[model samples]
Target chain A: MSEAKFSVSFAGPLVTLQDAGRPGNMRYGVAASGPMDRLAFDAAHAALGNPTGGTAIEVSLGGVILNCTSGAVTVAVTGGDFVVEHGGQKRASWTVLAVSEGERLTIRAGRAGSWAYLAFAGDIVAQPWLGSHATHAPAGFGGGAVLSGHSIEVKNTALREDRLGDIPQPEFIPDGPIRVVTGPQDRYFAEGAVERFLSSPYAVTDAFDRMGMRLDGPELDLKAALSIPSEPIARGSVQVSGDGVPTVLLSDHQTTGGYPKIATVISCDIDRLAQLRAKDKLRFAAVSPEQAVATCRSYLETKQAYLDQISIARGTLEQRLMRENLISGWSEGDERAAT
Target chain B: MPGHAPKFDAIADHAVLVSFADTISDEAHAQVIALDQALAKNPPQGFVEAVPALVNLLVSFDVMATDHAVVIMHLKALLDALEVNSVSGHEREVLVCYDTELGPDLDAVASATGLSVDAVINAHLSGDYRVLMYGFAPGYAYLSGVANEIQVPRKTKPVRDVPAGSVIIAGPQCLVTTLTMPTGWSIIGQSPTRILTGDPDAPFLFDVGDKVTFSRINRATYERMKDGTHHV
Candidate 1:
């Protein structure tokens, strides 16, 4: 089979292969361990014109260095702020580049964000456990983490001509307090506790991982018992432990939990939450389910618009920006009409 | 037991939590299973998957295709027409070795229950358990109906590196460890049955509504059976 191979010159802790993740397996006690930033992961694949659900090397804050050893393949790096260098020259994050044999790509932690993604234009050569290449490190499933000295292979590589050119980098805007839908177990919390949770600011603690993010904030007192009958846990569930500390569940969270959840963060904000590093301060705001749905739709539409703009824009980066402005204007009008 | 009216609450924009009752019971479990089966047979437009738990079912959908309001509305219609028939679940027999060599907490559990070690083993074997849910870890099946005589609280501090196939109990629930991890439950025995096969098509041996019973096995049999099948 035709394939391209690369050796992992170096890799940081928690770096593993991730795709769209293994969904529909939570009932069997498996967590969907996709990239923490879904939008960025999709963007990388979009740049390479790779089909959705292609596996990408998820890099943590510790960073990763890869050397292409054989054949040629197109690669794109996206998600969170990170410094990327290709061959002997510096390359911009979120840009597509072609890699041939004997070339090296290095990525390191930048000023912000905790995770980055390096996606290939071909299918990653790995044995998929439970129909996914995504690794659930906590459970030691899906082939484990990619460490230094490991070699990766990709087959069915896409031609470089089919990939998109450099696109305009969108400015990151900090959305206000993360939005949440007050809970499936909200009754377990006292009224005052709910108020305190919404009003107070919480700092992301050092005890953060793919499973959950522990926040140091007001201790949310519960009206009911600390532990309830184990129930299926959703991503972004803000569950209070016996110590009164609140932990926001992430993509790699367990399928079920015994702790009562006070609220669930809206899907649109999960990527923003995932990017937050230690000592990052944030607040929670409760919104109606309908409003949350509207926010999710808006976020998705914006993402799609971005992908559409880049794929069609040809000539230069400035030309892409000019076309992107026009598309945004049209989308704004479309949104108004729909409303 | 009196039947509980199901309550539907929006957990997120893409998910709805349907609670059959405030507490765990056979009636609630039946309702949860019934709804789960119904959804699987005829899923709504954007239905992704339904996860059945002890007394609740979590219905997740694709946000772009459908929202929580529409999904919940469909679920309500399904619930209204749903006939709470007794779900015929698969009955499984699990073999366990109750020797203290594999069961580190066997003596402690017997003392905590104020029963002889043999009586404790008998109490565990006599349990008519049901698979309540799978959680805490991959393929860690939480079985309900732990006998009251042998019921005990979870350990205050969790023990580290509990091995797979460990049959553990705590507060009316029992579980077969599917992975080597930390746990707060009391390990009363070890099972040779392979519950988690790691197969994509059929990974778990027990579904949420399956019935389970325990049988005693010798250490030699446990060793023989363990090597023949995949553990996790």
Candidate 2:
């Protein structure tokens, strides 16, 4: 409790806090409300040695200016590229930073991507309702948008860390076809619609958000897309609504829907899509559920290997690069040197 | 009684969808629930998620490292091994106050079915209802098995916002609203009995096979219950 501090500023579209999410409450009509980018959320916390269940500032594409009041803590920024500043100096993301009391930390928008995570070293300051601090926007559980001038209490846990490894750049990420399986109401559409759906190269439209990802591609021709009563849909579920637009359900999606879901994106690929901003081109490949499971395990294994390499590189260059921005040779700037 | 195997195919790279039938039916629903129960009891490898729908179960497993073709085969084997004949005998009875004031649509419901309000109440109260499933809202149960006399069509234009605890009836079924939601169901009476609560130990008071019942209560009881001075 003594380690917890209040927020001094919220510069962007910030929310209370979130983690992997609130699950098992779906039976009670309560959606599992948690963070948008589950993979990044876990990765950030893992890098900080924080529990996966710990609370973190889930910032939207719009960045924020967060200032803590007390206790020395370790913090990490993951998900989307965001410019972070510590004590008015340019800081870094995807890596951990140890901060003292009363320091101002700012995270501003950078290149591409939608969401970002600011994970504290300890438990967040808030009463847990239904076992999570992550906001369920629709349910109105955790309050929305961390606006400027609003202050939130954050408790610091015992964190002992001098420096974390190097934060990897964007391209270091892997790219692959998003896998899918046919949906329950999939038969309601015309014969070829499902085929076209599996083969078509759909672009993630600008209409993407935490609630749903609207895809743009071939217009599905359904002989009879009867309106059925709204039923349950899970995250990563690709539901083709009445208007023929395919929307991939995400974290903030409703508990149930009436649309005809032709396919469901694989769980492993969802994080990849979550990192993708609007207009990102991606193709869908249909595979069996067993195949999806197999592929995801391999993909996770591949991702783990890359992360391991990144970790090794960071450890080897800990003092020279990651810890201190040390530049040995090159006595002058490139422009000046060329002159 | 046709003993048949449900068709299953990959819905995504990581999820395999097991369909009991082309359309939702009692037999299909039974098969799905039984298979879902079996899977929950013995889940697959890299098995990250499972969601049961009306006539199908969407199972997501780790596909990259594991073999999906094999996993689907295993699921088909498990399905072949299950018995789909029984309508699960489990029951959960929920208490609700049914009256005109609490149920605004009681008059319309009775009128639509050409029955008296008391008859409507008797029909609703005397029968056994199956808990169709939990969705729409937290702990809200979409129960089936209403008598022919209590059936009514949903409002052409649903309400913009229906408060929680609203007992609704539409199309030969009854649905309890656990949260404030917009619905097309005919609003009858409101109940103080919370079908949905946030206790993990008592996660859900009603499972899919449970039954729900309604009891009549006066305005005094409603007010007292609303004020936390009474319980159903």
Retained native contacts per candidate, as fractions?
A: 0.78, 0.51
lDDT of 2 by residue, A25-126 (tens): 553456676777776777676666565567887887667876667677777888777777886668556767766778888776777667888887777666
**Model 2 residue A126 CA deviation in Å:** 3.7
Write down the lDDT that model 1 would get.
0.84
TM-score against truth, every candidate: 0.92, 0.83
User: In model 1 chain B, which range of ten residues has the least summed lDDT?
Assistant: B1-10
What interface RMSD do all candidates show, one decimal each? Answer: 1.1, 4.0
lDDT of 1 by residue, B1-232 (tens): 2376678889878899999888767788889988888788789998888888888999999888998878888988888778768466899888899989999898998899899999999999988898888888788888988999999999999999999899999988999988898999998889888788656577788998899999999999998988887754
Candidate 1 CAPRI classification by DockQ:
medium
Provide the clash count, candidate 2: 43
> Which of the numbered candidates is closest to the native, going by highest DockQ?
1
TM-score for the A chain of candidate 2: 0.83
Listed per candidate, the RMSD to the true structure in angstroms reads 3.4, 5.7
Best by lDDT: 1
Q: Assess each prediction's global lDDT (C-alpha) against the native.
A: 0.84, 0.68
